[model samples]
Target: MWKFSIRRILIMIPQIILLSILIFMMAKMMPGDALSGLIDPNIDPATIEERREALGLNDPWHIQYADWVGGAITGDLGQSFRFKMDVTDIVGQRIVNTFWLSLATLIFTYLIAIPLGITSGRYNDSWLDQSITGYTYLGFATPLFIFALVMLWIFGFHFGWFPTSGSVSPGLEPGTVDYVISKIYHLILPALSLALITTVNTVQYLRSEIIDTKQKDFIITARSKGASESRVYNSHILRNSLLPIAAFFGFEITGLIGGTIFVEQIFGYPGMGQLFLESIMIRDYTVVTAVVLLFGIASILGALLSDIILSLVDPRIRIK
Candidate 1:
């Protein structure tokens, strides 16, 4: 296991290096430099040159990129060209906000989706199955922004149970219970928006796998041995059915890391996705590169975890 982990990490090093090169080039290829944001149309040339030099804009591209990449290795993400603060600080705050939001979404989606899918698949052709299928279809079919808007209208405007947008209430003191509650209050809408969309699609994937697993020859054999349907399902089918869902779980983690951009934007949450959008709009290359690296690391690690999980849940996978 340790060997596999080390190997995976080593493999990802090149990918990240390549990713940096591409992101840096893409950013450079944009309309202008980071100074474009700060420059005035009537700004004097001398002052502008000073600003460019201050930003190392006049440095050779390779030298600048080398410094950036070198700093990243030392845990310094460089200064945000737009914000003029440590990129590490900005990313840290957004990461904390995103962590909770993503955590809530992952919990809600898996908790509801997995059991609902297994139960429905276990009772295929039943009303429960039909109902679940219909709901999943609706969720997967809807566009994320539209779904978020509708949910905001229903939950925020109509019901008034959950806050419509933002990550927390304004002016709440940090570390207080009130602060925590306010945070939760704001998290509900965006988390729910992401969860509702993911759960439906994930459930369908799990359900199909389960239904197929239950029809295998081993299942028929188990039934012939006078095992109860529940016994066969619990011991054999469920284990095999998990093979496919385990794969989906890998992508789920990636999606959780950065897929909810629309919902995050809609809610005005300061998660990575939201930060990523802000970066893209102004073509903030350094920030965008860092965000991509962050997401890339997370996804690769998640895939490694999912592989371990797959090995555990299915003996066939382990043997191979």
Candidate 2:
């Protein structure tokens, strides 16, 4: 297992490098540089050119890429043109916010999805199963941002049950219990929005897996062994059915980052998703590239995590 893990890590090194190069080139291809947003439109062309030179924006793309790569290796991600701060510091603050939201989303998704899936599969074609199927269909059909907006309107605006925007209520002491509660309170709507949509995939996958696994010869053999219905289903059927869901767990981790872009923007939540959209709007090249690269790395790591999970869940499946 350790050897497999080390090999995967080594393999990821080149993937990350290639992903970074693609991200950097794509950022460079944007219509304007960071200076475009910073410099005055009325400034003389010569002054604009000098500013570019000073900021090293006028250098050859390869040279600029080299400088960026060197700085990135040493933990310097360059400065944010929009925020006038180090990109690392700016991203660091927002990523913490995103992490909490993502964790909440993951918990909510599994808690709600797994039980529904199990029930639906066990009672296939019954009223309860039909109802769950209908709900999953609705969730899958609706766009995430639209669901977020609807949730924000109903729970946040109409009912006033939750706050509409931001990570916390203004003016609260940061370390107080109230502040922590407020943070979680503000998170509910957006996290639920993401989770509702995310749950569709898991429920459907798990339900299908359960249905298929139940018809297998092993399930019949378990029943013939005089096992109780509960034991047969729980130990044989449900355990085998979970393999696919376990494999999907890694992509769900990446989705916690990539999927939140629209939901965060709709809720005005302070997270990497919102920061990413804001940076792109203003052409903050450093932040944009950094965020994209982070997403890429998350995707790679998520794949590794998925493989590890599969190996752990099914002891017969060796990494080698």
Candidate 3:
């Protein structure tokens, strides 16, 4: 397991480099650079050129990429042209906010999904199973934006149970307990918006896996040996069913992170998703690249973690 983990980590290095290159190239292909935002009939051409030069935007693409890479190695992501602040600091704050949101969503998803899936699997073909299946299908079919809008209207605007926008209420002291509680309170709606869709996926996947695993020869043998239904499912079936699910958890997490972009925007939450959306509108190349690279890194890391989990859970994965 240790050897396999080490090998995966080493292999990820080049993959990460390639990912960064792709993101950088894509950012370069955007219609304009930071100077695009500065365009105005009144602004002097020479002034624009001078500012571009100062930003090294006048440099050849290779030189600019090299400089960006160097800065990145030292943990400097670059400067946000729009915010006029260190890209790291600006994005860092948003990352923290998104991290908390994502974490909460994940916890909520699993907490709800696990028991529901197990129950559905245990009672396959029953009304409860049918109802859960139907719900998940509708969830999977509906667009996230529409679901978010409906949820926002119902919970935020109608019931008035949660804040409609922002990470927290305005004017709360940053370090106080009330501040932390306010942050969580505001997050409930957005987090639910993210989690509900994912929960359906999780339940469906887990339930199907469990149902299939229960039909296996070993599971039948366990049941024939007079093991209680709970023991047969929990001690035998559940563990085996989890292997495939664990293998995909990394990509699952990456998808959730990506989903946050639109979900955060809908909720008006101050997370990486919102920051990225605003940056693109303003053509802040530095901020865009930084956020894209951050997402890529997160995806790679999630895959790595998933691989480690698979190795731990299923010895055959490590053996292979």
Number of the top candidate by TM-score?
Answer: 2
- Model 2 spans > 4 angstroms off: 315-320
Q: What TM-score would you give candidate 3 relative to the actual structure?
A: 0.94
How do the residues 1-320 of candidate 3 rate in per-residue lDDT, one tens digit apiece?
Answer: 88998999998999988998898888888888766755573688898888889989979988988888889989998777677789989987898899999988988887888888888888999999999999899989988888999999999999999898899889999999999999999888888888888889888988999889988999889888999988987798888776677677777788887789999999999999999999988778888898888888999999898888888877776723
List, residue by residue over 177-199, the lDDT tens digit for candidate 1. Answer: 99999998888778878898888
| Weakest 10 consecutive residues of candidate 3 by summed lDDT | 33-42
Candidate 3 Cα errors over 4 Å, as ranges: 38-42
- TM-scores of all candidate predictions against the true structure: 0.90, 0.95, 0.94
Against the reference, the lDDT scores of all candidates come to 0.81, 0.88, 0.86
- Any runs in candidate 1 off by more than 4 Å, and if so which? 39-41, 315-320
Clashing pairs in 2: none
**Predicted candidate 2: what Cα RMSD to the true structure?**
1.7
